[model samples]
Target: MKKILFIDRDGTLIQEPDKEIPQVDSLEEMVFLPWVISSLNMFIKKWYKLIIVTNQDWLWTELNPRENYTNINNKMFEIFAWEGVTFSHIFECPHFESDNCKCRKPKVWILWDFLSENDIDYKNSYMVWDRDTDSEFAKNIWVWFYKVIYWDDKHNWWNILEFVAG
Candidate 1:
């Protein structure tokens, strides 16, 4: 079984816009945070299988078109591919919080589904995210959690490397 690093997309990897437009709605808005590529590469070098689990509640409304979301997400993949940091899988819950979706953050269904389908060492796995929901999700699945402070200028990917390394 391989150790995995379950990560969040928005805020954790890319900076999130203001609450009014909280998502990376377009390719132009899809930008990686400082040292994110380097930090992800460090984990890759260490042989951690990366996976992305994100909640896209905005996708439920016409205000945020699904096509735009797909393009922006594809852009993220393209950017990461250039640096050789490919995720093993990416899971997203498109339902809003009110939908009570089983795959949303704070729920273990998505992670459990992945675990059942893969050879994962839960004891060695960790969750890297920027929200309390993600933290709760990690706890639900009994994995170590690291809440990346996306709002702090000092909390770059290098810091994440040191945190996991130490």
Candidate 2:
């Protein structure tokens, strides 16, 4: 079987833009982008593992980092419970952009780690996100298997969800 798909939550699946997005440990702050519910539902039926890959610079910069993490986690559980979307994993990069860590997207370490742990097939796996940085990150790590899908109408990012579901 092909490996499961990895996804980005902010902007791509939801609209919590980089600046406004909290730690994302909670559901209230984790709002979905338009068509996210339906689009992801389709992928579920296709038997793909819908994992959410995110960058959480908020945790590192929050006024009270530990408390911020606590609140965010509560919100995330609540929101997911309501939305009925169970993620295989929620990998986050809590470091600032300057941290220059390899776990960040475009870097393959995390996804590669996920695949290694689960024995997933990279050849059959794919990634979807809505930001230039994320696209660049996934591409840097996964290379040809990564695809950037436009969330709305712009071609600036290609919509791999549409292509795969169709």
The estimated TM-scores of all candidates read 0.91, 0.72
TM-score of 1: 0.91
Q: Candidate 1: which pairs clash?
A: none
lDDT of 2 at 18: 48
State which candidate has the highest lDDT. 1
Query: Which 10 successive residues of model 1 have the least lDDT summed?
Result: 149-158
lDDT of 1 at 73: 80
Model 1: per-residue Cα lDDT at residue 104: 87
Candidate 1 residue 13 C-alpha distance from true site, Å: 1.0
Cα lDDT of model 1 by residue, 1-166, tens digit: 8888999999888988776858787777777877889889889898899989999886857877888888888888888989999999888888888899898888878777667778778787889888787888888877888878755765667777887764
Off by over 4 Å in 1: 151-154
Residue 158, model 1: lDDT of 77
